[model samples]
Target: MNTLKQGDAVPNFTAKDEQGNTISLSDYKGKKLVVFFYPKASTPGCTVEACNLRDNYEVLQDQGYELLGVSADSAKRQANFKNKYEFPFPLLADEDKTVINAFGVWGPKKFMGKEYEGIHRMTFLINEKGVVERVIEKVKTKDHAAQILA
Candidate 1:
């Protein structure tokens, strides 16, 4: 798989949202997209990052950016998280890691002195033209929204 870089066209993907609604990248061709990949739903770090996005959602909208979160979680879990936090954005259930692998965010990670392979908390800022504008690799879970907004 090719690692995407700035100016590279984001790989097109279709995923089911928490509500089981199918969302395709092509559907948002003319809008800026902030697509973030997290490890799981309802986990500590993931929850904080998601809530941060919720708290800053208004500002993000004001800036004309659309947010979409992805994880190798089930639709049920995503729905529960969305309902619990009242997130204003959709979270895609990438149960098979299709989107995660396509974006090169699925790889080795170190946790508690152990090495394992999983989604590396990462965010991609895609431009209106579908090209990657920037990548946030060293994401801070608690201040994720601020990191992206910065």
Candidate 2:
């Protein structure tokens, strides 16, 4: 996977969120954003990461960051996960890999001694101008907010 790196410009794209609302990168112009990509919605690890963000949503916003979650799940599934967790952010339902591929997060993944192609759990911190300021590949699901804050 050709993962995006710090200092790179995040590709402009639009996709549907859990509410079937169209969201675009352009909408976040002039605002710092935290875009996190997870393997799936409602899964164990994914839940921790999302909940961590949700739990600290206010602090993150106070620090000038808007959060967004992305995954290759359908809108219905994403909605369920968000509703269940009461996440304070929007979760993009990237069923067609539009945002996933643009960020280069989909590639080979190994699990249970088997290898398969899947979405890599990653997060990108973008500055106000849309340039990636940080890329967190080794995400600490439970302490993700700390990682981002740090």
Candidate 3:
């Protein structure tokens, strides 16, 4: 998969949400969308990142942005994470890695001197026209939302 550039048109995808609801990228057409891809759900880093987005949800909403999170986690796990955090956004369960691979976020990752294949933390900002406006590749979990907003 090629790394999507700022002007690239986002690939259309349909993914299952925590509630088993099918969500299609087209559903959010004509709206600014923030699609964040993380490695897993409920982990420390993921939790902080999700919470940060939740905390800044109002601000982002005011700016006319819709947020969605994507991970290879199961629907059950995503539900637990969403419910636990009271997340006001959809978390896509990409268990088949279809969305992750489509966005080029699934790749090798190194941790503790070891490397393994996983989802790289990334966020794509898509404009109202469905063209990517930015690709946030270097994410700092603690204040990710602020960084994205910046």
TM-score of 3: 0.97
Residues 1-150, model 3: lDDT tens digits: 366779999889998999999999999989999999888899999999999999999999998999999999999999999999999999999999888877888777889999898888999999999899999999988898888788
Models ranked on lDDT: 2, 3, 1
Among the numbered candidates, top lDDT falls to 2
Candidate 1 lDDT by residue in tens digits, 57-128: 998888889999999999999999999999999999999887887788888779999998888888999999
Instruction: Compute each candidate's TM-score over C-alphas.
Output: 0.95, 0.99, 0.97
Worst 10 residues of 3 by lDDT: 1-10
Clashes of 1: 0
Worst 10 residues of 1 by lDDT: 1-10
Report the candidate with higher lDDT, 1 versus 3: 3
For model 2, what is the alpha-carbon lDDT of residue 24? 99
After superposition, the stretches of candidate 1 with alpha carbons farther than 4 Å from their true spots are none
